[model samples]
Target: DTVSYGRIFKADKQTRIASVGIGYADGVPRALSNRLIVKINNKKYHQIGRICMDQLMIEINDENPIAIGDEVILIDPNESKDLTLEDWAKLTNTITDEIICQFTTRLKRIEI
Candidate 1:
């Protein structure tokens, strides 16, 4: 089944999909769509399909105990090296500052 606006994500079997409430409008680059890997409940999942204006989707296993309101780490240094701002910058062919600037005021910044 299709997951997002542009790309087609066809699962071989029944898959659990979770929708994240952040997207390009929230500073997530559309160029990272289908390429970004997000962390949830200490597990990593690949973001699938095209990123919407205010949301994205990730594939999860049926057994994953992810629930609503669980935190999704889009850029976490403690989780994985790939989830760093530097990596995101390289993936989008931009600098880290540009990536940082894209995050709109709508997102709450939590320093850890």
Candidate 2:
């Protein structure tokens, strides 16, 4: 879910961020740390800092006003219009198939 980063000491800046409940433990490659981007409400936002065991934070700008349960697009699988699994493959210097297969049992799949 979304969080305001470092509220105790860094409250002045009020950097909005979303900490997704998926990370290296969920088959997310560690190489994607600080390099991945996710889409929220069709707008792009870069991931910030290192991706942890079970979460990754995306920087949300001031105007976006993201909520706790807003949809987050991790990999679209269609590179023509948005970030895709292949994109992540490139970032990790691996193949798309590996990228697709790397996701662990920790994730839940929903069929459309």
Candidate 3:
């Protein structure tokens, strides 16, 4: 155990909702644990359930919203739709650098 934590993500942009593939066993520190606040269509939604080793769950109840393959912001420069890394830092008393680096290189990043 590398002493990492997990976060439930329900990020979005306008109406494109996304549930991130992230969780505890992925080196997500338990300290940074909670229902993550994702700004979608200028609103926040709750990430439901306890985080798993590979992925957590989120609610995507938008009307005529995005599909399974639609693009959603997980970690992007667009702060308007998703929570800032600074927010994560504040929440866990960590830093932005640490938070972003949490993911191992083996993880594939699909930015849309």
RMSD of each: 1.7, 4.5, 8.1
Write model 1 residue lDDT over 8-65, tens digit each, in one string: 7777788889999999999999999889999888888999888899999998885779
In order, the Cα lDDT scores of the candidates are 0.88, 0.75, 0.56
Stretches of candidate 3 off by over 4 Å are: 1-20, 25-32, 39-44, 80-82, 109-112
- Cα lDDT tens digits, model 2, 14-69, are 67666788888888887876678888887888877667788887777658667888
Which of candidates 2 and 3 reaches a greater lDDT? 2
What residue pairs are clashing in model 2?
A: none
List the candidates' TM-scores in order: 0.90, 0.80, 0.59
**Lowest lDDT block of 10, candidate 1:** 1-10
Model 2 stretches with alpha carbons more than 4 Å out: 1-14, 79-82
Off by over 4 Å in 1: 110-112
Report the candidate with higher lDDT, 1 versus 2.
1
Give the lDDT of residue 35 in candidate 3. Answer: 42
Residue 68 error, candidate 3, Å: 1.3
